[model samples]
Target: MDMNEIREIFFQECEEQLAELETGLLKLNDGDRDPETVNAVFRAVHSIKGGAGAFALDDLVAFAHVFETTLDCVRSGKLEPSQDVLKVMLKSADVLADLTNAARDGGTVDESRSRALVKELEALANGEQPAAHAAPEPVAAKPAVAAAPAPTDSSGFQPIPFSFDDFGGEEEEVLMVAPTYSVTFKPRAELFSKGNEAALLLRDLSRIGEMSIHCHTGDVPTLDRMDPEGSYLSWTISIKTEKGEEGIRSVFEFAEWDCELDIKLAEEAEADDERPMIPVPFDLSLLEDEPVIGDEPHVEMHVEPVVAAAVAAAETATGVMQAAAAASARAEKKEAPAASAAAQANAANAANAAGQTIRVDLDRVDRLINLVGELVINQAMLSQSVIENDNNGTSSINMGLEELQQLTREIQDSVMAIRAQPVKPVFQRMARTVREIADITGKSVRLITEGENTEVDKTVIDKLAEPLTHMIRNAVDHGLEMPEKRIAAGKNPEGTVRLTAKHRSGRIVIELTDDGAGINREKVRQKAIDNDLITADANLSDEEIDNLIFHAGFSTADKVSDLSGRGVGMDVVKRSIQALGGRISIQSKPGQGSTFSMSLPLTLAVLDGMVVTVAGQTLVVPLTAIVETLQPEAAAIHSFGATQRLISIRNSFCPLVDVGRILNFRAQQANPVEGVALLVESEGGGQRALMVDAIQGQRQVVIKSLEANYMHVPGIAAATILGDGRVALILDVDAVVGASRGQSLRQEMSLAS
Candidate 1:
């Protein structure tokens, strides 16, 4: 490909490396002292620097070099990974990510921040203690020792040193011996196809020591028989380097499977009396008639003389050849067991990845899902037609249609599964958010996450980030009390926030809970009255007072800060969630803490719904929201006021809401005794008996966005096409209940009037 494409691939890899870096640093911060973790973090930064240097991204290269140097010190155990040190590293990771993003997207990072972090990193690298507060625990301070000047490459960037010395002192001495080896390498066509350049490999080999190479062209064919993509050349090389045979082998590690390679130690000088003489296998005159391939005809004829000279030299080196053969045999015998073990491990890995995964663009998956949705709709229409034509349920056409419906449903489900992903990455991001916010608020807080592997639709996960971020910030800034206050309240000095996710029924429920002083009810109630949101002496319940926080422009903070209380309140969070067909609620205790729970549909494309008729119109209620359906008896129905009714179920009273009246389907409320009552739980964990005219069969229906296609209906989540080709509105249970409560308050006020 062209340079631009290569640059794009580099950036893509940088993203993966950045993620790995963050994950490793987080593990270390959590008290995982594994040396491999530090190595991994260092490697990520090193790789980024190498690639950035190639692309002329000087800023990225410079910053990453310094970061990598500090990480190298930690990797080598020269620096301890104390909590204070980890904190600095985490911030460094953030800054590195910012630099990467700025480089990719055409922007600039804060120079002041970058310079300050560089100073801190350089200090740690130089073995200097950090600020007093960040100093490691005192036992006895070791005298500071200056680090050796790191070796630099042609680009003037220092490479992290790697040596066998780290493994053992004896191995280091063994690595110092200079040994010569002869290598034969023949590339297969696949090597070049995979973007592995032979010239680049040769250049890397040249870096180790001196080398002489001879190219063989025996495999090349005449132009008529030539395949442009075929491999037609091989190379034999002699090299002497201080690095061991393992180092030489590592130079071709990436291409080993794509080439034929052999290596053997070159022979040492022998005494004059022991020299063996060998005769040339072919006469020099025999090669003169062979037609040679070269850039010019004159040059092509010179190949005969070159071949003659090479053959004569080989004859004089018979002793060296014999020694190389012996070395080859010994090397093979020594490597046999290790090679077998490697082969077995590779087999196991291949078996595990037999069903390999390939990344597909999300737009393609979304298109497939849309097509499946259309198929579901058409299947429903066909089933309806078949039922109408074949009046008898036992008809062949009806049975076929039923089978077709089942198959279509399975296809739709499979398509949706392709779009489902775990929320772990998003949750990990929240941990960083918690740290940054805690630093800003000057509070000691810890965020613990559970059930991060809960899978949800990609669309839902993408939209959740913003609202979840706001909630996490709010929990740190407002939900948690100061460290001193927490201690005074007989709680741990460091407040804890627990974030959890789980699949409940057919919905994904996420909760953010904090262990700190809970909502102050009196403060909230008085604030509501002072803002004219509620009348004085309104007699609001504890739940109602807590929920007032979600009202538009509501805040308990006396002044606005960077984190919250700038007129944008929980109401925006509620609206955003609701827009995704989700609901959020709050529960608070006096001194314990508060929990914000959000329930959202698994997928927005299709839903399992219970069909019901209200005010002579068919409507759908999400099956997940329905607790049970019951027939209301006369004795079980009671009227508390002109418009308020309650239903008694299992000796417990629940508010009864007429669905038709709430949706404006009818001007007057329906009689509870004549309609089917659906006992359902609202967002706030309150039960409500929703009155519907009758219950119909349940079915899967494709959801079409009402707001996008038309306008937002107050109580309707979305519209769907039914089997009879009629449009049905899907009820938003939380919105309907909210409307019912507002209606009740209006009636109470009118009564007082």
Candidate 2:
């Protein structure tokens, strides 16, 4: 691949490292004192800095270097990860992400913001209290790379020489005598499970210099009693290499987190070196197959019995036998190399398959989804055609069609899952939002996120960010109380905003909650009146008052704040959700808290729907929208207002909406008693009974966007093709309810009256 492609991979890796950085820092903030967490956080920054330095991204490398240095202090336990320190590190992570994004996308970074963060990082590195809040003069821009830089390309990317200091020390000077060192490595189960092999690690180490490795197999149990997956083997090595200890450590860097490793000068670990160890020569085919450069080949000694015992012991303990029999055959150096070629080839292919991954273009995936959708529609059409034509007993064709339908559904589900990704990235972003908003509002706030790993389609996740961001901003700015206010209310000084996501009832639910002063019912009521959203004497319940925040043109704030109210208020949040085939609701307890729950479909491709007919026109209602369906009773119908009607169910009277009149499918409302009523939960947390002429069988249908092809209709969500090859509209239930309450159905009732 070319440098541009390599840079793209680098950027992709940067995202993973940034995620690790954020997760580790969050753990630190939660009072986790695990050393590995600190190391992971440091490694993430170091990796970014190293990559940045290679491209001579001076600004990025500089910021990441200082940030890494501050993290190093935490790793070494020279600095405590107090909430203050973690706060600065979290901000640094955000800046690092921004810098990386700018570099990858050719965008501009905020010099002022980065400069301020650099100051804080420097302060923390110097063992001083981090005054990162002060926007002091930015430190001078300097390349974090130490080695000489090569000539620059047209893209301004200059490759910097790789440095050995990252491992431990400089390797520029060669010693007269290679330094002898002792290494004791103990493998944990995680090492092998993570696709790391101790044999491979040993192979890399043996090439560094002249080395003798002794395998310890005393921990191994008998074959039947031993756990195949358990790690029961370890190795000790004595080496004299001019490359120094740094080179040795670099060999095992990938497995360091999964294994117990120790490296010291021979003099220091001489006592631990006294243990008896089996001479498991690194020259074995599996462990030391490759010939090391600069070393002369040794004459093979006829020590078959010793080699056999060692191979068996190692194989039994490690369980990493890529080619155990082939290795055994190769133990006799006189054996023909061709004897093991077939086995070796098969083993190599298996190894490659274990770690192979391919990155496909997202546009290609989208096209595949489109094709699968067409396949589903055509399959439905074919099945319908076959059933209608078959008067004879063609059970074979029927069985084939049944199998085909099942297979088609499987393919559709599998294709849609390819576009599914966890919502962690979006939730991680909310951390920064909470911090920035809290700073602006001058309130101490803590954000706790759970269920971030809940998966949803890429389309939903992409649009989800904007609305989720707005809600997070509002939760911190509006839902959370100030520090002093929380303290006075017998709560912790730090207000908390919690974000969670989960799959529920064939949809994804994202709930944002805050432990602070909730919606003030009286205040919200008066604000609704002032905004002309409701009548002055409107006997609104607390829930109704709470939901009025999402009413268009309504504002509880005297003036718009720079935080959540940057002018796309809760109303826009609600509209954006509705546009995504989703709905948002609110539940609040005065002086306690408020929760904003958004339920959205998993994918935009196929929807499970309840097919129905209204005014002789076919319509499909999203199954997720319908709570239950029932035949309305004549005794349960009651008139409301001058035009609207209500349906009484379970001692509760819910507004009954005529689906036909609301969509203008018919001029008059459908009789409630003669029609099927689908009880659906509306956007504002109220139930609406929708009257349809009849209930048809349920089926899975592909959603075809109307706005993309035709003009956007008010009460129509989208259109779909039916099994019999007819177009049917998908009813936007919430939109129809709104229309029924305000305009069309009431107008029809008035006209009929």
Candidate 3:
């Protein structure tokens, strides 16, 4: 394959292995120290090493080799997987990423950094004292090891060893031989002290045939400042050998990342030259044992395929047992297996055993969902058209159309459900963060997560990570306190950060609460006044003071700390949540703790909305924000001022806002006895009634973003296409009501108000 093809393969494999490594690391971090996870991590590194060797990418191969060695120690239990080990290993993974990116761009190896990293790896591999236990080793002076050979199994074909005396020879093979092959060599400036990696490649190639070396000094600068030991040169080699290109490529694999190299087969060869020979056919015998004779009738060897198939089939059967167990878990009694149910169970088991998770590109999933939403609109239009057609009121045709509409609705639901995934992964991520924060603060913190299985649209899940990270960090650094502080406050020394998620009234509600020092309202109020966020004499509620932390550039942490005292994380969380059509609220008690509750829409593409008509315009209010709708007599409305108003609902004066006027539409004077009042729940737990001309109906609307097509307009979340192909704005009820009052209700009730 050409260099470009090899590069593509390297990138693809690297990406897959990186993802596998990340997942395994996360599992390990979550306390899953299972042998499988360890083995998986090892396998990821091993595959990366193999791929690097094929591409003759020395930098990647070198890093993976060392990384694989360290993991091998862990796998063998010779080196304990201590937190320090994992931490260093994580850093090593980052270096591997750097090497990969650099190689992709055709850059020379970063020698200084590589040597430093290699020294660290050696220390880790040697099981030396961690940095905390002793001083770090100087990169140049650190002791070295000859390149370790790949471990031999029952079969031989041992990895070539590398040592410092043979680099010039290795450089010869890299340049003169293996010209048809592509070699990427990246050397640590200090690699010469440990191994003459280049010479080994030459020795390995001489075993096959004659080769030509072409050294290139393109990257070398003027000689004055150049360190002779540093690799200021790269090479392209041409070799004529019977050995396959891959065999020749492996010699420089370990140094691919640290040096620049290209190797390819020489074009012309002497027909009279003897063919290359191997002292021992290391892997040849293994291939010979399984030689293919014919498409069929090679039965002497192959019962294994049938047995493997049977084993897979049996695994699926076991999956059925698991599915049955799952179904029985939530049911009060055993459910009878109906025909369709049985088929579904079977299909599910087959799917499980097949273990083929359909990894759709996320873009494809989004497109599918969007198309389904359009289907829903078209379905609605069809239903509307049928109703309007009135074909002499034909009962059969009307009934058929209704059934078709129902089927279309079911299909839309099924498609949307495909995008829903349990929020367990995100919750688990936060749980890990909780542990990190606790360690940093030197405080006892136990994160208790509930409703991890609560499902949300994937789009919401993707955007949720940053906000959740900030919140968890805030809870750890600012919300919780040290053990001594907790003891003095009549709390458990091991403080608790409770993260709870659940579906509430068609929306997902996430609550992050901590049993530690709650928001210090007095301090917050004073800070707000000092910062001019409010006046000194302003009378604000405790809730409003708690929210000041969400204001940009506001932080209550008295001293800057590593986690979040610099005053730059929470406001972004608030804005992200709002951008997702969600609201965040905080509840706290002085000596107790604080709970931040965020209510988010279930899906970005669709929602159950209450349709209302006002001043010749139709608006859909997210049903989650609507408490109740009532056709109250207009006389019940009392004007507090020219614009301020209130309506008595359930013996309480709920604030009233005119939807038409709030949206800048022409307002009609209410017939003092008529008009509808829609009671809405504000984020602050306050109730408000929105006056509208009429309640049209309740239905699901596909939410289309207005901000995408136009700039963000307050009081409007998005616009939706109606059945008649007209556009109706989805009212952001919270923003509408808040903007009408010229301030957020939370701000209006601040302690400094």
Candidate 4:
């Protein structure tokens, strides 16, 4: 295509390489000393450098070259991947990523940081120790040094020579003999159609060394017989280069199946005394005397002397060329088994990938999901219409509609599955965030991740990075204590933050737990009082004290630091998670540790909801949040004060919240006896009995974004269209529970008054 498209592909591959580089480096940091891992990391940097040079990205090329050099030392065992070294390498990786991004998008990286890292990398590569925290020196601009010289328009398919120096010792001493080879290349019509240019291949071939080329026009037809798309041109090239046949073959690897190629060693030059001097046809004037083979045209050339001499030379070299060919055949036979084995392994890998996955444009998948959502809504409407028209449930139309409903649900589920992706990449990104934050805070922290392969909807995973990053930073900044403090508290000097994800009850649950001094309850309480969030004598349980951190404008830090204490993150974290139809809660124990748990919906497109009527309006409650539904007995209902009510289930009292009242559907609370009690767990792990007017059947419903099309309604996650074509509000269970608690507290104060 165009150079811009090629550059875009190059950058996309750079991203994949960057990910691979980070993954390999993280593995090394985790104590994996596998030699292949280092090689893979080095290859990633090397590949990026090679491509950058092709595009003349000088800054990227220079940085990647320096980074690759240091990585090579580690790969060759000249440098050990000690903790200190790994720390520097990890920082260097981040800088490399920044450089790559800057190259792709017009931006600048922190030059001072990159210069310092380059200095450190150079020191490591030279087997010299670099001073920690050394001031960065100015870096001079460097020209792009490509791994292989770029081809010009005149030369084609230049092969880069592979070095054997890395093998070391005598292999480096053995100078490869430059061998002359005769190459015949005839491209098929498909070659040019596939964007393979003969001139480009010739230009690359010229990079090897000196070359002599002969164009054969004997196959060309007259104007009347010529076909524009037909292949008529062929070339015989003679080249002398130190690179082996494999290197030469690689030049044509892209079009191997699209052309006819034959390569063999050219005959050695004969001495003047050993052979008669023959005047070879070196110019077009000599071809005037040669007869062309084609029927359409004829050219006569007088080359009787040259032909006779060439026959004599060929006869003399017949034995030699035959021996060389036999030897080459033997070598091929010797390497056949190894080559076959490698081919089998690669084929198996390709087969596995082909069977398991396909790279599809995300926009296509999104469109498909939208279509499936529409199908689900249409099916629901049709089912409702059939039920309304047919009084008897046994009608054939009703049965067909039920079947259609089941099929639509299956299709929707299958479509959602296409958007589900494992959270490992996001978790891997968080690992880097943790390292950077730990370095900034001057704290020794280790992040341990588990169940990183747990799958969630792609949209959920994308939005989770922000909230997850905030939590991870908070864990390092606020939850984990300093190394000295941790040791003083009889804990390990290096604090551990455990990030885990798993599927729980049709939802994804992620937990970030830190092993350090837990929440200081007294400090939090006094801060809440000082901030006017609570009174001086406000009685709050430990759970309530822990949750006070999530309140807006809440912070317990004595002084603001770069990492935190601006009272900005925790509250925003809560709001963002709630907006995703997810819940975040805190669990802290004095002097032990604390865990922040988040529960999120599997997908934002649709949800399994329990339909219920509240204040004469239909509402859908997420089934994942409901533990059980029960009819409250008269004796089980108790009023603690004038307005606060509790439901006794299994001898335990749960705060009874009227859904209609909490959502402002009604001005007054509904009677507990007349409604069904839904025993649901709130975001904070507390159980509450939600009182609704009546229970309707459960169904899967498509979620429509109310906040996008209209203003966001509090206590309502989103709006959806029901089977009857009426709009129904989907309950934000956590928000409603939170609102109910606030109402209950206000009611208690009024009763005290």
State model 2's lDDT.
0.70
Per-model tally of clashing residue pairs: 0, 0, 48, 19
Query: What overall lDDT goes with each candidate model?
Result: 0.70, 0.70, 0.62, 0.70
**Model 4 regions more than 4 Å off:** 128-160, 165-364, 628-658, 661-674, 681-683, 686-689, 709-714, 736-753
RMSD of each: 14.6, 14.1, 20.3, 15.1
TM-scores for the candidates: 0.69, 0.69, 0.57, 0.68
Q: Which segments of candidate 3 are over 4 A away from where they belong?
A: 1-61, 77-368, 385-404, 421-455, 472-477, 480-501, 513-516, 557-567, 589-593, 623-692, 733-753
lDDT of 2 by residue, 1-753 (tens): 334554565577689889989999999999999987887787678667655543547687678767876786677566888998899999899889999999989999889999999998888877643455221222112222221122443432222112111311111222438888888899897886764656546655755765555545467665435443456766677777877878888998888999999999888888754543222232122211221000111111111111111223333333322233333435445342221222222222222232346677999999999999999899989888887888774779978998999999999999998999999999988888888888898989889999989999998999988888888888887788888888889999899889999997678999999998998888778876776767987776565577667766666676765653334578778767866777677888878899999988899899889999999999999898899998989999999788889899999899998888877788877789889999997655467989999997888899998767785666777889999999999987766875665534332222112
Q: Which stretches of candidate 1 lie above 4 Å from their native place?
A: 1-6, 128-355, 630-657, 664-674, 681-683, 686-689, 737-753
The pairs that clash in candidate 2 are none
- Which residue pairs in model 1 clash with each other? none
Locate the minimum summed-lDDT window of 10 residues in model 2: 292-301
lDDT tens per residue, model 1, 509-589: 999999978899998898889999899969887777887887777898888899886757577777778778887878888
Residue 378's C-alpha lDDT in candidate 3?
Answer: 84
Off by over 4 Å in 2: 128-354, 392-397, 521-541, 551-554, 559-561, 564-566, 625-658, 661-691, 710-715, 733-753
Tell me how candidate 1 scores on lDDT. Answer: 0.70
What is the alpha-carbon lDDT for the whole of candidate 3?
0.62
